[model samples]
Target: MIKFFKKRPPANLPDFWKTYENCFLEKQPEEVNSVRFVVLDTETTGFDYIHDRILSIGALNLINKHIAINQSLELYLIQDHYNAETAKIHGILKNGRGTECITEIEALKQFLAFVGNAVIIAHHTIFDINMINQALERHQLPKLLNKTLDTSTLYKKTLLTSNVFKKKDHYSLDDLAEKFDISMKDRHTAIGDAYITAIAFLKIWTRLKSKGPLKLKDLLKLGS
Candidate 1:
């Protein structure tokens, strides 16, 4: 006789989380131009995912090649862990930055609502996505279900094979800014960097489309 282990029941999630999850029930758009994309950046205390915490999150909505300035989101979290060294980099003080800081849970709620089921875009997406997921885990919440695109990865595909030797293994946001001629005015700030990444993504997307037709699946494949 074989004995099987019982599956664990789903954890009771809050209404906001439930609402966020519900958005995924609708089918995702197949056309690249039709899909809503959320370009985001997160400033953290340090590199250690488990040990460090997110100091702030900045994101904006992009659809049909247009950046929705009014839909942009910027949230600062009240941190229990702060690194002075990193603070010098991001400039988010423990006390506050004249802007009101919300609790991590509150930030998560707002972030989820703002994000919905939109595809996430970031410079180095894994780090930012992991940071957000870790925060969600800490609150007994599940990780984000949205698809993601990394500008660094997507930008790499825009390069020509003739100049293969000139390609670097990794491309930094600063490199994209200089190559695309975007301003570096908000270099270290989360929202500023996100805006820069959004611009870089648009430029990269346009270049990719110049070669051939680019559907959402095709772009996601290239990004992956």
Candidate 2:
């Protein structure tokens, strides 16, 4: 006789998560022009994913090179973990005034519903992705299943192969903003950075397409 182990049942995901996951059941857009790109940024208490918490999340959806202000998302999370040192950078007070903030669970629920099946883009994609994943884990939710793109990597591809300007190992959002002449009006704010990233992404796409025909698959390969 052989002993057999029973398969574990899947966790019962909430209706919002189910709806978000169901969006992926449909095939993703193949053409770059038709694809929806969500540029997101998270303002955390600190760099440590396990220790720090997301103070706020800002994201905007870009389609066919257009970013509509009305379609943007800005969620301020009620903070349980606070760091004074990092506060100088993000400028989010623990008891900040003028706006109402929601719990992490509430914010994540809305974020998932808003994101749907769009491809995610960020400057340093991994850090932001990890932060969001950790937040999900805290709420016993699954990690994001959407594909991600790093503008830093995409920006590098836009540069000439010639030895004239050696590509730096890393690029900051400010670097891209200055290079692209984008305004820094909302620097350090999640939505503001997402807007900058969205603009930079379109500029990068223009440069990439100038070389040859482009598709959604082509850019996915460059994602972090």
lDDT scores for all predictions? 0.93, 0.90
Error of 1 at 55 (Å): 0.5
Residue-level lDDT of model 1, residues 1-224, one tens digit each, is 99999754348989999999999999778899999999999999998889999999999999999999898999999989989999998989889688999999999999999999999999989999999999998998888999999999999998876654677889999999999999999888999999999999999999999998789998988895
TM-scores for the candidates: 0.95, 0.94
| 10 residues in a row with least lDDT, candidate 2 | 6-15
| Model 1 stretches astray by more than 4 angstroms | 1-10, 162-164
Q: Looking at model 1, report the run of 10 residues with the lowest lDDT sum.
A: 159-168
Candidate 1 TM-score, C-alpha based: 0.95
Error of 1 at 63 (Å): 0.2
